[model samples]
Target: MAQNLVLIAGATGQIGASVARHVMDRSGWDLVGLSRRVQQHVPCPMLAVDLLDAEDCRRKLGGMQGVTHVVYAARYDHAGGELESVDINLQMLSNLLTAVKDRPDLRHIHVVHGTKYYGHNAGPGPVPYRENAPRSPRPVFYYAQQDFLIQQQGGQAWDWSISRPHTFCDLVLDEPRSITLLVAIYASMLKELGLPLRFPGTQLAFKSRTQFTWLPMLARSIEWMITDRTCANQAFNVVNGDAERWSALWPAIADYFDMACGDPEPERLARFPESHSDIWCDMVSLHGLRPSELSTVAQWAYGDYVFSPEWDVVSSMDKAREHGLTESIDTRQMWRDSFDFYRSHKIIP
Candidate 1:
């Protein structure tokens, strides 16, 4: 039997890390991960390569033999706005494609996208965004990357797949940009401060429906896309087959921390977490938790985006279900499992 080697880019990131871990646990698959920095707890072989530099990518990735799959989860965040973000992200993908274009054994390439493809990031859009929804008018890198993949696949042996997920939930600890970690840190801080676990956004956001994609679920969807022929050359929305309202779920979250749920306290989370740095420090000492600064653990800007939303962000998972990927998870149970995992790792009290 031939060996299957899967290359996972951005292996330390939320989506990429989950994919790598999932692939590692399976049989008859070899895993190779790429990141700018060396990850400590990853279970696969990792290569330190900067995807932005074309020459560096060629030098490092050109020689990897027998790579059958590529999961492109690498991303570059630019603060200068959409145009700059599009340019840098496009260049990075182009560099990776140019380096790997010659691999004969490559059978599939999967790109990870998000709800921003449907204009959720800019403002409200139609509910339950299907795979065929019209592209957003704003400049986005998802279109560019998909177009690049289509162009590259012309007369080539490899096919491509894309998965769009929303508000990833994973077990990464102390990751500043992870919404789950931010919520956990925020709740822990509130507990230490003797404050109620309040719905810290507008009333609309508290009541508005939202969706999430568990990291492992997204990973499994990617794997199904890679292995299932029916999923080739198609984009699908992969979410936890349910929608939730924070107004109803806030109490469960508050209960997890043994705090009372208070009324909505609409405030910019970007500025909120910083004010409680001293409280976070005191909590770390009181709980005998990991020694790390609050800023390194909580991302207030991301929290604000997750909590202060005015519109519902729900995507249709019917496409994925129709294709025989029937995995689903309960949103509340997913949160409980994640919180337990964090406590087991000593990330929160």
Candidate 2:
């Protein structure tokens, strides 16, 4: 009896999961989640899908009757610092669109993109990256995917919008790519070794201004853009309204762990888990913490990439504000709250 039936692709990822909850809460829409793995904890019916397999996409999404909107938050797996396959990523989106675009009630499709679109990973682009900035000289799947969406929507009744968010933070404890969980687990390991908390990146990185998109606010913004008619056929940058340098926050983080703040020591955070596996095990047993392998708790390669950005990574929020999605969160307070959640949930000792 619901007016809308929304299909959330990549539903098990942090963005997809959080957005699913927010869409359900705000609009009372019927929901379905599409991902390779089925999560028992997700809020809606989950379709185990293989977006890479065109036949699988057809079998699963081809007949999703009454599906009114698609929130494509899915990404093809790729290692950090590696070139993502443009063909593979584009095919995934193309498969999803082919399967569902003909649905009579389909009104909108929303794509979740990231700051990598601005070339933050390759080095840095212009500061406060505006939505209208030219495509990065480097090859990225984002360019291919966005272009495909625009091409496919040429004469279709449905409309599309894309959101470009930077590193997004949520308090979810078990997420492997979480920046907050990476920091929590790293600090716990270092504390167990009786070492001071060190800023584990270059001096330039420590002092660089960066921004984060609070996950909940991003979910709300996605919901706003999809339902609001004015946001159609456009792309907008979604981020915390403010930015900060790690140098300004390192002291507070050190204080939170009750440890001294040491000088910046550039480290390959990807090496931490294997190097300190024994320490992690000891901490888990000593604190009676949940049993989980340290490697499974956080992917430090993601940490390495996040902590190694030596240039300022600011994205402008003016476009989203002008488009009428004005929600914002304090980045520093967002971090503190995330750490507090991990502690309350006993995800860290």
Candidate 3:
């Protein structure tokens, strides 16, 4: 049997880090982590290759040996409240594939995609988004990447799979894009201010049903996709298999922080943190918490986008289940577990 070596792109990110950890803990595989930043803490060889530069990707990745799998989780940098660049995003993936696709040992490629493929970011997508749903007319980078993968893999021995997870719920301390960490930070700030934990978005978002993709579950699902031949060239929506509204979850969250839950009051979270830096610094000192700047701890605009959605955001898990990945998690428990993790890590007091 050939030794399985998997190259994980974006290894410092929430998804890539979790997946790399999963691969590391498992037997019968070796891993290499690629990222633009140097992550000395990751438990594998690291490649500091810029995915945006085709030559850089080639220079660093072109000489790889026995790379049996590729997990493309890297994303191009872009601000919230705008469409991510299709050309640049597509180029990143193209650069990676161009560097590694010639390896005869490569058996599979798995791309970590998201619900945005359904245009949920722009507005409400179809209720309970399915893998078979038509391509969103909106020009999203996800479509460009997927199309490139489909075209590039034609008649090739290496098969491909895509996992579409909704808002990722990650517990990694270093991940700044995490919704779980963002909310924890937000609630802690409100608690320090002696204000009730007010729902920061509109009433529509408070009432709209939403879902989350537990990072660990998504990692396992990606492993299943790569190993299971049946998953070849298919897309699966990987979610917690439960839908929830902020109205129901907000109170529980407030209780965890020992604060009262206030009714929905719309506020632009993107601007909320600008005025709360001193409060966070004070909390860090008083609680002996981990030193993290407020701005770097969370991307407030992402929270604004998440909390302002007026439509239900759900994706069917039946496809993954029918295909033999039967894992499911309780959405409420996921939230509680996330809070517990942040507290354990001293990310919140």
Candidate 4:
């Protein structure tokens, strides 16, 4: 119905690449993907440009020049080794916004943010965060990118929206991209060794009440925001709409992997209560290389988070529903899809 030209930054990232692919599927929309390198297997039109450079990014991001919309997924992905990731994100954000300033055809902007903006870095509060909640005072540098958007949109000249999705998992290809999926893979390894598939060693804060969002759903939602004016100037929470206990979710995962969860005796568990480890401890144990081979049964257990006894806050998308967004993905189905995808790609070794 409409001619659209779209630009996406961070096109090679786990989320960004998926978003790019989805947008490319649009009939009347032209998608330009910006990345540092032209990786093999990319289907969309890509421009090799450094987003950190304001001038180059402006020249390269075609959508800014009478182009339809811009989606900023760019971030420092050096495995979190760059301690100044927040600062880097904020600067790139400021540059990108300035580069596209005052473009006539720019209709909307959709930025992907996680629940980390809800002060997950601080701690979960009972606030049940709404889209309009006050920016966190202890804002991480990443939040600044969002604040910049709010400031730009406050002028009311362009269509703008933000999506705060919760606990999304990807193809389990890396450490930082999909942490929950990383945990799932670890749990799979545990089941291989006849270990308990349930939360081991510690009780988590959220007690494993978590929801997952699928890749296709997240990507398409961004596309929806771009084409629909009704989505303007609002914030939305993306949830998988399914919640499950941390303990019970393990069996579902076991079924997906076709692996058996070893039954731990209740009395024996009571005696060796310290057998399972928190997320961090389990990682250190596994990577510590205590055993040369996988011959010994590693008594340690792996779970959702390194820190336990904290509440895993559930995000609600009720407000988004009020604004004409009704679609969502199922958690269990989404996780199984990701598992199958990773196995198919041989991504998890």
Candidate 5:
């Protein structure tokens, strides 16, 4: 049997870490991780390389032999605008592909993307977005990377796959952009302050339907994509296969913390979390929890972006199911599981 060695880029991120963990425990496989910061727990051969620098990527990844698969989970978030985001992200993917183009042993490449391909970041386009949905007019990095990969693989033996997930929920302790963590921390802070677990968006947002992708579910889908021949050169939407309104879910979240759920307050997280920093510190000290300030533990602006959206955002999972990747997760259970992990890890009190 030929050895299967997989190279996972952005190995420390939520999605990438999930992929690394899934691949690491399996038999008959080898894992290599590429990221700027090496993670101590990811017990794999790791290289600290910046993908944006073409020469750096070449020098670091050019010499690797016997790499059978590449999972490109890396991303570059540019706040300036979409054009800059696309340019830098495309360049990073191009550099990595250029460095590894000569590997004869490579057989598959998987790209992880999200619903931003449908212009969710700008505004709502259509609900339950399918794989065949029309492309948004905006310059999205997913499109650029996909186009570049297709162009580069013109005559190559290896094929590629793309997986699109939405609103990733996971228990990565150091990740600041997790909306699930934001909710947990916010609720905990409110409980400590003798307040209710209030919904912090408008009524429209509270009732809007939404879906999430549990990181592990996404990891499994990516594994299927790389190993299954039916998934080659295809794009699939990977989600939890369920949707819920915050109006219905907020009470369950409150139940987790033993607090009462309050009505929607229409507040912006950008200003709310910062204003309550002292309270968060007091809770941390009182409960002997992890020693992290609120600013370090959560991104309030990201929370605002996630919670303030009044439009329903969902993606169809038919494509993935048709291709034999039929994993699903309950969104409510996923939230509770994530909160339990955070509490057990002392991330929150």
Candidate 6:
């Protein structure tokens, strides 16, 4: 067997964190972590290097021997909103690909592709986006990013795989990504207020769509794509095998918080409580949400896109399943796990 030296860029991130740990537990790969701040020792050996500098990335990575796989999960976290995502993500990916262009020992490249790629904000995508479907320029980043990979994949020697996942849940010691997180916290607040029965939205936009994957499950899929021969050079959408609505999820969160909730009316959320804002810190001193600090309650709430059954994201798992990877996690349970962990870790305060 060939020495499976896997190089993990951005190992400190949520997905990257679990990927390293999962590889350690399930496989025999020698891991190399790349990050700007090597503050805490991760689960694997690491190299502290800035990947933004193309030459630095290439030289340091080029000098490394036996790196059979590379997982590029690192990107700029400093940018506000989605403004800098495209340039930052595409540039970093392009540089990394350029760095390893001449290396033949590498067998797989697993890139952490986000959701915006499927459709633009409040998009009309073909529900359950298939890998073979038409590529949209909406994400702005997807086109360029895909171009880089397609250009590389054309070569007979280089092997690559794209893992497009909906919002990742239950990250390692971090907040969940999908709007569901906000839904849980908001429901908790409503419960604390002793509201009546929770109301399901009558609107028709989001009712028909659902897709999500827990962090661990996604990490497993990414690992399979990197190591398994069947997954080579294929693009796959990975999600747990379950679905639900905010109304269905609110009760669980309300129960956990020991509060009562009724049908959410326009009046209740009309005031736009300070707790619901993305910048929660600014509003904490004004309201008494019972927390010591203003933890953004709406982080999980899909921003400006809140009509229940109004909008959605449905990622297809067909490609990955075809590649012999069909592991699944319960969506509701996963969200509950993330909420429990966030509360325990004091991340939601």
RMSD list, candidates in order:
1.8, 1.4, 1.7, 6.9, 1.8, 4.5
Total backbone clashes of model 4? 5
Q: Looking at candidate 4, what is the lDDT of residue 33?
A: 80
Q: Which regions in candidate 3 have their CA more than 4 angstroms from the true location?
A: none
Q: For residues 1-349, what per-residue lDDT tens digits would candidate 1 score against the true structure? A: 3378988988888888899889988888998899888878766799998999999999999988998999999999654223437878989888988898789898999999988899887888899899999999998899999999999989988899999999988777656777777778888888877999988888888998889999998998899999898998999999997888888888999998999998898877777756877887888888888888876677777787787668888999889989999999899998998888878887898
Ranking 3 against 6 by TM-score, winner? 3
Model 3 clash tally, residue pairs: 0
> Which numbered prediction scores highest in TM-score against the true structure?
2
Which scores higher on TM-score, 4 or 5? 5
- Candidate 5 per-residue C-alpha lDDT over 1-349 given as tens digits, one digit per residue, 9 for 90 to 100: 3389999998977788889888888888888899977878665778898998999999988998898999999988655223447888889899998999879898999999888888776777777889888899877889989888899889999999999998898767788889989998999888987899989889998998778999888988898999898888888999999888888989999999999999999887777756888888888888899898888788877777778768888888887888787678988888998999899999888
Clashing pairs in 5: none
Off by over 4 Å in 1: 79-84
Candidate 1 clash figure, as a count: 0
* lDDT, candidate 4, 82-103, per-residue tens: 2337777887877777777567
lDDT of each: 0.86, 0.87, 0.89, 0.63, 0.86, 0.66
**Off by more than 4 A, model 4:** 59-65, 78-86, 154-157, 171-176, 179-184, 198-201, 258-309, 345-349
Instruction: Choose 2 or 5, whichever is better by TM-score.
Output: 2
Candidate 1 vs candidate 4, lDDT winner = 1
Comparison by TM-score, 1 against 6, better one:
1
* Candidate 6 accuracy as TM-score: 0.81
Q: Local error of candidate 1 at 227, Å?
A: 1.1
